[model samples]
Target: MTEPVPPRLLLVECPGLEAPDEDDGGLHLRRFGRVVEALSSVCPWVDAVRPGVCTLPIKGPTRYFGTEEAVLVRVAEAVGEALGPFREGGRDGEGDVGSGDFRLGVAEGVFAAVLAARAGAVVPAGETARFLAPWPVAVLSDPELVEVLVRLGLSTLGGFAQVPAADVLARFGTRGIRAHRLARGLDGELSGYRVSGMGARLVAALGHALALQDLQPGFWGGTSAADERAGEVLTALQRRLGTEAVTVPVLEGGRGPADRCRLVTWSPVVARSSPASSPGSSSAPGRERKGSRRKASQAPLEPPWPGRLPPPAPARVTVGERPVEVLDRSGVPVGVTARGLLTAEPERLSVDGGLWVPVVAWSAPWPVEERWWSTARRRAARLQVLTADGVARLLVTERRRWRVEATYD
Candidate 1:
């Protein structure tokens, strides 16, 4: 482990899990979440860089673990443990599953760290430039620039880095300037690689439903006009701490909870709208109205949300994925079949390796097969089950694994 540059970053990348449009219906995202959680034990500041990828500053972990090599090994072990059960003969019957093969590497910043992860090599301290030299321009991910560089006889990062900064900028504009910095190991992150609010979206995909804050009347004064004050305060906070400082959860029309809700930055406009406002209400502010109201023939009909859970919806949606082992009377794991029917009656329920409780009653599975023709196609099912303790829960399963999705009071 060579000395680190200004700030050393350790990157963990799991091949085959980077595609956002994979057809696993978010199983990959949830597994990545688990990997992130596991890495948190090593360092609290672990960052989920993107799907199938995460990074953490190596300073703290190295100090605690004694060496950068040790930290890398520890991180690898943590990810492996988190994704254990799904490694072999998994959902696809191929020896491939979520984070099945994780690669780890350390470098001064994110751009180099990612390359190091792919090559499974740690960039020596202050030697990032030399380490990145041999890689072809294709790794830059800019096809046009790669074409230009090849024609110009500068086909490698080292060659590109040798170009005078002024010349690169004048020829390629700001984009080329940034790429040159990356090639020179002067920049850490690239724009457009990170998906905004991806962590929140991942959590929301698992059934977390957050409510937007509602304005309340002032205590001392009679109907204190706090709406305006609230907006001012939120605006100030955003300006100080950045726009992502304040966010409000909004539920929209979709087939499932994940599709229906997301966190959007809070703004005065968002605060002014009524949460109870239903369809036909003046459209919500901020968001563009693409298909607001159809012409005379195409009225804006209320979204059916077909197959959505009936009223008495779960009181709380779990924030994280809770792995549960549903067992039948024979003590074998219960599974769902192709027809969306259970292989055996569920006789007991256990939440996150908890004590098993007797299952009393259950509802018919609500099978869902959405977007069947697209790469984003998903197939899963949900069922409501009651335990002998009189508690009810919503359980969802994809690829024959059961998890607690939500709980009812």
Candidate 2:
């Protein structure tokens, strides 16, 4: 368990605001709301783990902003600005609100990630156990267990981690086992740290209508408490997990399913705003993006990865890596030409070195290509084939190698 590598995540902590009191008149919650809103601009999946702590998957931002260190800089700046608005009123109520009010860190798991944020340090990859070893057992957040462990000379997580897993389970039961996992960096989060339904509570604390409140579920052509609640739950889960952990399919213009379909973070606001652009046969398993027609006389002869495939959509889209062999009646291999035409008719096919099956019918190969002069240009083709066994399958070829692209039931 010492090497139980943690997930890469980014955490934001607001120390002064974690324990908001009645005397603060709900200002802390409102300010925290602004923090979440600002962070949403940086990442749609900002999880409000609790009142003053939150986390987001660090991978996307790291790749986008260049590095984990860069992500922390960017997040700290955004959170600072969010808390900036309340700064002028610092003397009135908000206490010294400034960029220093927030801290950001990057780590692999939620528990380690949270401590990293509080300390404003990045827990280097594979170093979570090292980073946590010296911390007191109290950070585990089990006060009663903390006392017992401390009394037993397990004052620090490192010592506590030395306790064998079996002993922890046999002596201290489930709670001790949980704490031991945290010590050894085997668990990223515990049960009680994240508040249930935090999204709903945040909305209630804001005490104001949301930007898209009236049309929250309008994209589905109707609205209901059920839908709104569901959206809230999704938002909560996003806060608990990272945004990349949740996604929704979006249809866009392309010749094939892989190019036309994408997975995006599910947001009711986005759902309501985006249009239903793709049109496909009722039989297709998924919604597809439709390519627009050219108005000018001299556009490229072939449409740019545009247009729907003729009629009855595929019942299934494939992972598309399954290799295949296609041959003509003469047993010569078939191929697509520089002119985008087949060199020979496909008379039979075999999948993954299995027995050959005669091809009873196949549509004309549809050419796929890049611009004529691009150095790294791509050239491929897709064809529909009906085999002797009566299975309707879609096949594609590039550079003479063939593979399954989809299947029709």
Candidate 3:
């Protein structure tokens, strides 16, 4: 059996930092997500560490595209298309936003890829050590370690790497050992374990034998060791506590507070790419066709609905079985009147078994009437209120009852 190929990694850096305001930060994060989604179209093994930095394992793509340079060119073009019209002043005359300078780097490992990105260089396979040799020890980002290296006259990465590995470990501990390994281009040695093809075959045979013996295999084909271990753990827990014991969060898109997200079974395959499928392949089930093209043509992921609540969205939203009470000055429960107006001004609000909180400020009520022509039709008006304790809440009134929809921290 042939040995597994060494990973070729690509690092992509976005142009800017997050803005100070919450809304601005959300916008930046959304834009960053778009970039990663776009890159996923080219290579599914993309990992976005933040809005500004992401890495992709490009070994498969480099082969599929014919050459490493070809893959790089394709990625650059894809990014440029996805981030349309980002000019110097942030927007063009037609109001199209443009992304600023983007840097791409390719190397044998993540650390090397990051350094290559900083210098806008691509280090070829088996040459990572040579490329990193002349770089300064300060690149490690540990000021204390750099000072020690400087005092020892080891200013370059090569000099630092030349120190005995055992001595480095003895002096600076694990962190220093890791830095020394990277400086010596031993990233793979430090981070990954190499299992021979014979060993993998033996493990697979053992799994099959266990399955035949009426025992669960707890392993799947073509998955990483980490994924197999997680599956085993989940299987053991479920066997002891039943299937419903384990669940994972799933983010759903919607306009309502309660409809936005939910929980489902923890399936490892949910995020894993299929080994038999290629990126942008139409043959893959449930895979989008022309997704990349559509993404390139559309505006960024800005808010789709107008007149919605602004950012710093609610941290907690509770839906109660019974309605809460809102009262006016005369101690009367405030209800919606005939003309869609409140029977009396809302001065204070209280939930069952909870203390009344005075309303400090409020905005005009916005009415929503859904499925008006059907038997399930419902009408409600939503009010945004700030309580005396400086908490922002969304309240909705249906029929004669008031309920708190969400609370913003």
Candidate 4:
């Protein structure tokens, strides 16, 4: 056996993702071509002969580039330019998803490098064992071997790798030994591949749904109360999802929930708003109606919509693959977004054909039943609802009577 030259490896995994069921194989090829072209510019020795694969031999480039960190930055920039414009819009304004979406991993052995690329992670030289130690057992195919190891409590790559190779083979046969050897980064079939340019090892996406309740209130003169509420809901959601904080503005104000105007506020510019400069203000009838302020005296602990309420406490939100980092007033990463009232767990509260309430000390619907047909009543039914934020006790009526007794979010 001979030791191979230590080569820095770049493995690109393109899942050929497109609109679901659109099976456009040619588009996938074009994506690969774009990535390869980007990578080749940085490392002139790039090649794209493999289908949906570009192997970059980084030995020469590493020496020329001086430091791997610098190389990574340059490659990330080049790939970003090559991918053109893949941005995360709507809520996240940090940066767009482009060439930088790619993952690069370097290791002493080719097999480990390939695995690292597939996993969208990186392992510096001589740390293959440490990197592979926490990987799942399913990375290897044999189930019987896994069961035997589990019974012995030999879980994790590190534990399995420590067992004698001969003993593993003698008990579980050749497949078990092969699995063990692979775990130790000793695969014989891994052939080193050449690099062309830039490639992405993984891709993550975020989809957003704007708050319906917030946009109902007017943005100007504080008519869009629901818009602001929607913004609050969005803030709560973002806090849960683990993304950067978002600013919200009204799309329309003083309309119904569906008619409320709302949109995400992004862009680095912060221009001051002038009251006289607002568009279509001269024609709006409510612009001059100054008796009462529409903006909530304080953002309500619970929204005023008929059936809507702030969720209970102890919520968990995952924005994407990246962990959420809540920022302080100074814009520094503060903490993960998981907490009480932020977890958006769905719970249905209803009876056979009417409104139902739980936690009332009995299964019978006391509050709703008492006020079934009280149209002229000033006060009607009071019921408590549970959510991720906390418990909200609400009062309902047949007509213009409504009040929220308590809420937790």
Candidate 5:
């Protein structure tokens, strides 16, 4: 047997990309190019094949940069610097970029490399088989040829490689033959990233608490070891940004304390709940309830985008053009409460006074009347009002009284 040619692959995964928001696709690719440019600085010979994707001929970098491990460390650092601003708000308290959910995979070949990236497997050379054998055939669904192999029961890459190439083509056609060749490490093919980086990008920061911790099967707390790792990453990000006031903007529409803020022109808004109605069980009980409430809001409504329209809760952080301090010696917000954004009047409320201020805002009667027959809770009215501070949500109680629940600051 003769020696097989060496294969070196690098796979990068960038998460948090939303589907395109417009037609041009140029802006998307441009942003991706920026990231590629940053990566190019560390490894100059890298090929910027697409906006979000790039590859370095690993042999050159490994040789020039001293070692494969050293090259990867440089790549990781450069990527974090370039992409860190994007993941500004993370659930884990660590504020590192590419630290949120992005991953990288290094392997001996392109197929194995991409699989490793998806699986979060960073395989060293001479170990592709250990990494590739366990992955199911589903990942090969792309390239059309792999799907044929899967349908023929050659589900694993290892399995595909073992089959005779001539027999594979005879049974499954030309595509299968091509797939077998690639699977068996017989070919080297690279697809130019023609689409570019086409998507919307939002930066979010995982809270410091989230970064230093992992879920313990059924519990929530930071492991001491993980906490040290988080501290190192946080310190690195701080050193890069050159600021002690680095606070990530809270993501809007989050389930708790943070949400997006928009500068929409203020208007009196009407609120309505999706009338309780399940699909297909119609015309008798459920249909009657929905029909009864059509008169409440005349606007035609679509089914609730699952959980998108959950009752808005008052978010607790301060949001402004400048960063707000999040902690003090006691680990408490020295400046304000969670609701301070909704009530604190910078112009009127004196700093020396108590945190609470009396502001008149509308509150919807709690237990707003709903379909009486079904189990769904309904209310007669939903409160919509604005304050000098911002917007607020009030909940009516079972006793028919109202209290401020949440505010949009």
Candidate 6:
């Protein structure tokens, strides 16, 4: 078997950089992109896993610069130059340039590089296992695996790595085996250990091409604080319950109140854009057409439905097992005649057997017939009434029974 490739990874991190509040715009990504661009000048083979954390293959850069330490110093200088002047008290306002300590780590694999970067140290070639031995298993970011290891009295990477690989695989599956490997300084699938020197050269060439393409300037935009907070809360709630726990109210195309609206899975990105842009509008950059409103309205329209309800839709509507009662003066139930009229005008109403409310005013009943050709045909007459307490309700009568269909706030 061929010997494992010696790790040649370089991890670069910007210390004291906080994730920007979504409201602060894309400032975080922009700054991170700038850093990536700067580091590309030193080593074109760069991968930005997140805003502040980045990795690079150091073999080619080290050969070019004559030493691994020289490459690290060059990367630090590039990051500082890209970040510009240092601002005291951290990043303050929009458009203000700030600088932070740039930590560089060089080791055999990605995981070892990350650990070294955090400690501001460099692990020499082939010494990754010794360097990572004393670190905690929590660095793997797998809470369950860490907990299991701690319970087994294996808290440090060295202790956990002592376990048999087959046993770890049997106990924890693929993820557990991966953690075990990382603890042993074997960074698993994505690390340089899996790639030969020839493969690294090819990957470096492809990365360089991609970096050049990404150097093009891009526009940035801000996000709403309310939308950001709402997304965070929804994400947390989904994590506790299942993803199906959170839903959003969406308006659909229909005449009936119930048919016009629906509940859908919540999406933060979609929700953020929905409130600001209109349907069919050009949301893409530089694609907006001027005077599109007139063009849209002037387009051929569908034949109008004569039975459509007039303006002033109800603000609230409740539909479920609970029923409301509408009664006449004699305490008898109010019924709708075959001619789509109330037999005895509504005199009182009660919701869910609550206190009776006297009707102050009412409008003429409007009939709505649905599924006329089917056995499940439904016929209802709706009446808008004002109660003595000044509440407006839309009451419907179907099969000689009355129910509160909706209400105006």
Q: Model 2, 362-402: lDDT tens per residue? A: 87666665333478876677878999999988888887899
- Two-way TM-score contest, 4 vs 6, winner: 6
TM-score of each: 0.49, 0.49, 0.43, 0.38, 0.41, 0.44
For each of the candidates, the C-alpha root-mean-square deviation to the true structure, in angstroms, is 24.3, 23.6, 19.6, 24.0, 23.3, 18.3
Estimate, for each residue in 1-409, the C-alpha lDDT of model 4 and write its tens digit.
1423245465554333222122643444455555654565456554342444444555665676787666666666665565544433445523423322555556545556656777766666556767777876655655777777878887776788888889888887887877777677665212224333222221111122221112222222222423443554566566776435564454343212222334435222321231223222322342321111211222244333222122342122211221112223344422111111211211332322334333322111112222224774332233334423334333222232223333332
Q: What is the C-alpha lDDT of each candidate?
A: 0.73, 0.73, 0.63, 0.43, 0.45, 0.66
Clashes of 2: 2
State the displacement of the C-alpha of residue 52, model 3, in Å, after optimal TM-score superposition: 1.2
Query: Stretches of candidate 3 above 4 Å error?
Result: 1-6, 17-25, 88-99, 188-409
Candidate 5 all-Cα RMSD: 23.3
The residue-by-residue lDDT of candidate 1 on 132-164, one tens digit each, is 899898888899999999999999999999999
lDDT of 5: 0.45
- Encode model 5's per-residue lDDT on 151-184: one tens digit a residue: 7787787787778778878886876665555565
Q: What TM-score should be assigned to candidate 6?
A: 0.44
How many residue-pair clashes does candidate 1 contain?
0
Worst 10 residues of 6 by lDDT: 216-225
Clashes of each: 0, 2, 3, 49, 34, 1
Off by over 4 Å in 2: 1-6, 23-25, 88-100, 207-409
Candidate 3 or 2, higher TM-score: 2
Task: Show where candidate 5 strays beyond 4 Å.
Answer: 1-6, 17-27, 90-101, 142-151, 189-409
lDDT of 3: 0.63
Residue 45 in candidate 2, Cα distance off native in Å: 1.1
